[model samples]
Target chain A: MGSLQRLGRWTLGVLERLGRGHLFLLRTLLAMGTLVRRPGLLLREIYSVGVLSLLIVAVSGLFVGMVLGYQGYITLVDFGAAEALGTVVALSLVRELGPVVTALLFAGRAGSALTAEIGLMKTTEQLSSMEMMAVDPYKRVIAPRFLAGVISMPLLAAIFSAVGVAGGYFIGVGVLGVDSGAYWSQMQASVDFHEDIMNGVIKSMVFGVVAAWIAVFEGYDATPTSEGVSRATTRTVVHTALAILALDFILTGLMFGDI
Target chain B: MTTRRIEITVGIFVALGLAALFMLAVQVSNLGEYRGGDGYEVHAYFNNIGGLKVRAPVTMAGVRVGRVTAITYDAERYQARVSFTISARYDQLPTDTQASIYTAGLLGEQYIALEPGGEDEVLRDGDVILFTQSALVLEELIGRVLVNLTGN
Candidate 1:
């Protein structure tokens, strides 16, 4: 009976936390209107989130593309369909890997950083001090970061896909000796803008919103201590990764389930 | 100031992102393929379209000369009407061109392959190619093969 009571209490605690997170996201979204008044702050956050994340995103994209090319070439050669390597690589990256992988990297890199930065500010009493000074921290701090994340995600995903395609070309055509013209022509013939690429963009944007929401909410609600900040940052990464994967599945189903 | 430098870098970053998006739209997708002035349309009717889709390439002797623009059901004739536009550079195809839907590679997309016949007249806009071969249904072929195997 005591253990059953403990289980009930644990479930209630999780529900409460989830409710708080939802409220925090709602408030942050409402505060986003103030971002237009301070474009410079938003741009700075974009630099920190988007530009700083570019190196890792690009490098990973290139390597992923190369691996895809090498693997796809080997598999396709067995069936004498080596010419379809480009279509395989391009479709896989643009439709599935590009947005999903970019979002995962963004969660690990930028999301954790945002959580840590905000948690540390909270621990240092900066957020509270700003509130005392008549500055809404939600508007000045969280909104711009969230807006920047949403704007940067699709761009980062696009760059990842582009670099990935180039890397695939380098390995598939240059190394594996697949016909270069066939690679590109087949890809162009198969991939549709509204069907494949735009769906990826929409996916990245959704992941951006969910990831940024989790990061800021965790940081803002963190206990004002060193250990608390670290815990919140870790939670931000874990939660963002899970959310991105789940959202990817749902988005894929909605986008391609019919066809 | 550092602020101006950061802004410039961000601008460049955003510009690069936009360029990548444009490349995806134009090079990867079919956005830049249909500019309207460089092609002329021709029509054909088939008993079955199979997996043929709009934007499927129209090739002549292994060269892409056009693309399928539209597909519609002709209820009156119980056939599928396919419209395609050939580029002006490849506009010299004879009026007797036979349009056959052929699959690219095994388990790949189906495309219209134009086999030009011996004729002096050239196909023009809105002209219909009277001869056409419908796409082969793999399932039907496999079923026929299975029936033959069972009967033997």
Candidate 2:
């Protein structure tokens, strides 16, 4: 009886989480409603997500590019095609790596905070006060973070991509004795301004919206207690990371027309 | 009063920015000038491109001046024909300039690399580059090297 009841409870838990996800989507749409009426929130989001996160995006991107160069050159050398290393690094970073890695970073750094902040308010009965005061928390809180994450994630992603390319170049041309002039020329030619860059930015924007929505939903719907707030924050970060990765695969297939 | 929210958010952005700066420095320095040098567009024929794709680099004397723009097979020729757009600066190539397929690293992509010829007359645009070396496939090269070493 105990084990059966436990299994039943597990099933219920899965369904509950799914239901919460749907509610989050609904609320996200609701929050986005304020985009036109109050555009200031969008600016705040760009500042918070884009400007603030540039450092991590840059450093991580550089190292990623460097490693790509270091590794790519070696593999190509064995194949007697060492000159193609730049293309490999740039394409991979633009098409997939940059957006996904930045999303994970954003989730770890900001997603949890959003969830906790909202959850804390929920536990403190502050959310109730906001509602009582005729303040739509969705507009005041969720919308800002959602738009900010959307705006900022792409900007940071671009920074990451640019940095990563530089990193690869440093290792390839500086250390590996690759011709600097040619290296740059090849990379420039390979990187299509519209196709590669646009794809990544678009992915980042979508990821931002999804991440912000997940975090906010966790916070706003959190139980009225301290433990609930903590749980909400943790859940938001983990779920956001997972969702970002899943979205990456889907978007890649969609954009590339992959079967 | 400083809110924890503001503090965490600010810290996150600052950290990300620093990383971005480092990455930018690497990319800019590595790529050098993006403009193509004075050179000629050349096509190479191959049985298999072998990991070669569009936008691959084209190198001469170990210096890159162009990239592979397209890869297609001429049914009549029965070989993979790769088109490379080289720069205008690298225009001086003997009619005997050889286009060899090379790679940056093992498991890396294919690139059409050029070797200048001793001839005085330069190859013109849309001219079929005659002296050519096909890509050395990794497996084939290794297999041959090992066989030579083993006297098999």
Computed on C-alphas against the true complex, the DockQ of each candidate is 0.68, 0.14
Lowest lDDT sum, 10 consecutive residues, model 2 chain A, at A185-194
* Candidate that scores best on lDDT: 1
Q: Residue by residue across B36-152, what tens digits does model 2's lDDT show?
A: 443567776777677778867788877777878788989998888888877778778788888888776645467777888799998778877776777787799899999999995
Q: Which digits, one per residue and each the tens of the lDDT, describe model 1 over residues A144-251?
A: 998889999899999999989999999999998999998988788788888999998889889888888888888899999999999999999998888888888898
lDDT of 2 at B2: 38
After superposition, candidate 2 runs with Cα above 4 Å error = A1-5, A253-259, B1-152
Identify the leading candidate in terms of DockQ.
1
Indicate which candidate wins on TM-score: 1
Quote the true-contact fraction of every model. Answer: 0.64, 0.14
Chain A TM-score from candidate 2: 0.89
Cand. 2 Cα-lDDT: 0.76
Pairs with backbone N, CA or C atoms under 3 Å apart (clashes), candidate 1: none
Chain B superposition TM-score per model: 0.82, 0.67
- TM-score of predicted model 2? 0.65
